[model samples]
Target chain A: MKKQTCSRILPLVALLWGVGLCACGDSAPELQRYELRLQGTTSRFSTTYLSATAVQVTLGGAPLRTELLPSSQRMNVANATHAHLVAHFWLRPEQVREGALEATVVLDDFGAFEGTDGSAGFVDAREAPLRLKLQGDALERNGRAVIHIDLDRSIGAERQGSRPLLPHLRLVY
Target chain B: MRLKRQWLLLSLLVPSLAAAHDLECEVSINEQSTLVVREYPATLTFRQVVRNIHPTLPSTLQEATDPLLEPLGWSFTPPPPVAIPVNDSRTYEFSVTVESLEDCARIGQVPPSESVEFTDTLQIGWDQGMATCSARVQCVPADTFVCDDTLYVSSSAGTSTELMPLDPTTLATTPVSSSTGFGYDAMGLSHIDGYLYAISNRNLSGDPIPHVVRVDRVGNIEDLGSLPELAGQEWIVGTIMEDGSYVIGSFLGSQWLRLNPVTLEVLGQGTLPTTTPTAWAANPLDNKIYGYQSYLARMSVFDPYTGDFTVFGPVLGNVGIQPCSCAFQQDGTFLLYCYTSDPTVDALFEVDLVNGVATLLGSTPSLAAGDMASCAFPPAQGATPAVRPSGYYMIHEAALERCLASGPVKLGLLPAVVTKEDALRLLWSSPAFTLGGEHRSEEQAARHALARQTLTGVCNQRLFGGTPELQRLLLDTTTTLGRTRAMSRLERHLGEANGRGLDVALPFSLRGRATPSHALEQLQPRSSP
Candidate 1:
């Protein structure tokens, strides 16, 4: 009788163990990871005091990262893919009167993301120089200007890229 | 062996069961913004929405995490860890108390700039993750120390000998014990060094004497002594100076006597420019005494150093009220309490020191003529000495520099130009020139030279041209001097110039004329002339 009981119990235990292994396999899998970074460089010859208003990172025309005044110092893009970064600045009146002009370019946004299977991610490795060129006289102008820094070009550069690729910043006003 | 295996299985099952049901909470506060006075507590209500995210198993909501709000003097009652049902949400409320202003500063929650919004966060935690809620608290410094700044009024009409304390802000009255044996008429009352000094009719002869007495806040009067020099003076107005001395002004002789605050003895004596000074107060901003002359209905500023009194202009309001009393605010603004016979108006006014314009604040409790005195608990520690610009040009230049340094320029809002005529009027009305005897002419000539220099400097800066600043300056000058004809002419010229987008200039012919006309003439462009 004891031999018969043991035989029945062994098969039941084996079935239970098989079911437990299947349940463990059905749990959610871990996510993947990717990196997106931006860097900006101001023109060495530029002497305009720049007050930035907006900094944003867009993925396929959709914003992945955005910051408004007065918190426009930095932006963080989460789960970013196919992203491009841009910043907006203005020439204030006091800057004109004081005759102390200067321009600042900021790598406003940085992001880390996990790519889905077969999805396109940030792949460019070449560090290209994004130039800021000033057109009009900043001291005589009063309006807005924009700086578009290519994420692929800013990948390997330092977070605060101070080296100027152009001679002057482009002032719309 | 079997028991050990069972115990191991039970331990694993227990943890899994506990982890299955987790709490999800969202915390919020009732008021987003509050203004708290120091040492005064303000209430804050916190509402927390707690939900059980478990699929099937029911779990009890346990204790929440510390909100870390102790630094702000915020405390909560009914310590957390209340139970919640599975797949259902429950709202929990808690009270937060802010103790003092010092704690508000320590918390570093106040905004740096005016109109800038600030938020203080409170974190509430459950079995799972934490949720944070924030409230904006704007802590304002309260005048909590103004308990001693009561307005003391003693009735001169009726037999009611009580010195009543009136709330300076509200004009509410509190009754005190009777001053039975003290005196009938209290002429002037001033609080100095925790005691109230009154110039009352408390002499042995029962005459209107300038007998000074010490009165406590509770209306207990103590006879200090009598001023022998002012023994028989009537209708005397007394003011306390910043140096703790009493300046008693007598209406009979038009004399001002400086008396020792403690002994009530005359320290020095001088004559006033005007005959009767009905109201007077020492301006803490400039340390100068200011008074209203009842006879002339003029506002005068007295320089204690030079013993010079300068009359600015006619007092703004109806000055028919006899025995009006004036007191100075910490900001140098004067408060005038007066009783008018016509319609029996007992009104309190806030006087603008710059223009002597009295803005009616409200009516007092009684319409009867009474002696008014004011005291503040935490007395004003006198602000930075304000230099009264001698002439209009000096004032204009200072205002211009301040406007430039502050922000964007608004040319139309520039200060009015102090013309030579305005300076002369101010100088001629001064006691130094009017009462200086034989030296008046010499002083006048010197002042005239100084005025010319100021005007020349201003003209060199292109401030006299057809600019918006000049137009506004001319309008203000005409309005202040009551130059009706000149004001009408200038207004017409200005309107025409503004319509054509042209600037106006002050004509050279009208430079030094009293009631100057042709002050605003259309300026030809520099390209033309």
Candidate 2:
């Protein structure tokens, strides 16, 4: 009679432990936050350099300033040496309208790169159409988006001397 | 021998009193464009330069001669006493008016043959001596207005595209009633004979046939049929001549055609020196067609009679951006509206034809980037009538003082004795009461009040001191036009009263002293004693 009682108590202990483990696995997943990165290549003949760039993010035509990660950056002449830039951003669930955000990036006083050698300067890239449509859900879920840009494909090839290649962007989530 | 020497000395002294001094006087009249049948306030500026040669004594200007300029009524206020120090010079500036210069030119004996030069003699007396100076003035009458100066602008955006009238002064816009249903891109616009004429490339059917149409003030449009040679031509610049004819030019070619504004019939055809004229307007001052070449950005003046073109140097402004339309102000300055890459932003420039410079007036927003047309209506003819004011009509403190001493100051229904305080109160309330709007600031009001007070004291002492008829006119209450109307009438009348002669009536003391004896005689006849 003592051996039979031991066997029934062991099975009951095992069943309680299994139920506790399942409850831990069924809890909600952790909330995600996102950051964006831009990577590009430069052309050898390109002399155009960006001094400062202003980035504006809008959700359905209204400007959104709060969630912009690293809102502004001073490029100076160091942009020519730096091949990559990282900009982090986050958006509230209510702020995302129609599941997208429009980004307009403008280069202020984008003129010729003054080389260390002190050569003649080239013309300025006064205005460039650098607009991007960002996915709201991916930025909210993944916590990171990496963009790849090709400088040659973006800018126009109108000038003969010291022409700057346009940059392209790619997203990796 | 002693008597002869004394007589010779007397002759020398007498001649010295009448001898001319080192003083010079000059008079000039503002130039005008044409002679009209109305009275224009032609400003005659008199400048006197006095050189005092007396080493120890300063020269004092005693009096100046008042010349009678008939036909053109002469009126001038006596200049203030000017003093020249020994061995120094002083200049006295006096402004006078020649009323009805146009009528004077048409009816005068010598009738202004060349540039309308009129000469009059002026004699000035100093404390120690006197001098006579000749005042020669050159004046040309300006062209009178043919119509009201209303600016018209056209739109081509949608079905609501229509012609609208814009106030030349205020830029206030109002839609023309007949601007509906006639949907086409207006390439050019002009006004003649109280009607608005427009040239459009697309007909009502949206075809590529160029047509000229007349639109009335109520927006009723009358199609004048297709332009013969201008079919399919997109860009056109045009202006209305003073004789009611239209000068239209094609941007795609060098051909310019003159047409009867009413018939749309091509009366004459000529070639523009430049290939593409982006904007053009008729300069009534010189009766030449002035325009801008789009390619060269140069100013070109085209003489319609000689068919000759005078191309000026390149205009200095925004490079490569051409004006979509241009119109002339009444003063012959060109107003240009230029096109920009951004559809919403447009630039307006005032081009000085004489100086060859373009000054940016301002920028207008929400205007489409394309070839827009504009036309300015001629200035309104006989709009401002010259009505001279009597002494009572002048509302300043000087007039008020004279009127107060004479009788009750009746301004509308409320008649009261006007004082200096009342004059100041009237001046303080002028912005609201006289101008009918809030057009003056507190600072401006204070400044105007101070100026009026100072002028009143000076003018009253000079004009109302010795005049009986003027005093009677100053106190008359029959000419009062109530309160509201009286302010405006008095304001205009006060403008005319400036620079008028102070000899309208004899001394009030002379008349009053004479009248008391007559009063005594009448009383003696009635008295029983």
User: Which candidate has the top score in lDDT?
Assistant: 2
Model 1 TM? 0.32
- Kindly list the per-residue Cα lDDT of model 2 for residues B421-526, writing each as its tens digit: 4433332222211222223444443333223322332334344442222222233223433344443443322322321222133344422211111111222111
Q: What's each prediction's TM-score?
A: 0.32, 0.32
Runs with alpha carbons beyond 4 Å of true place in candidate 2: A1-173, B1-146, B158-160, B167-172, B177-192, B369-529
Each prediction's RMSD over C-alphas, in Å, is 27.5, 38.6
Q: List iRMS for all predictions.
A: 29.5, 38.0
lDDT of 2 by residue, A39-139 (tens): 44445323333322345666666555323222222222224454334344434454444544656555432233333333322322322324455656555
TM-score of 2: 0.32
Candidate 1: C-alpha lDDT: 0.42
How far does residue B15 in candidate 2 sit from its true spot (Å)? Answer: 99
- Candidate 2 chain B weakest ten by summed lDDT: B512-521
Off by over 4 Å in 1: A1-173, B1-148, B157-160, B184-192, B202-209, B319-321, B365-367, B376-529
Instruction: State which candidate has the highest DockQ.
Output: 1
What is the number of residue pairs that collide in model 1? 16
Q: What is the TM-score of chain B alone in each candidate?
A: 0.41, 0.41
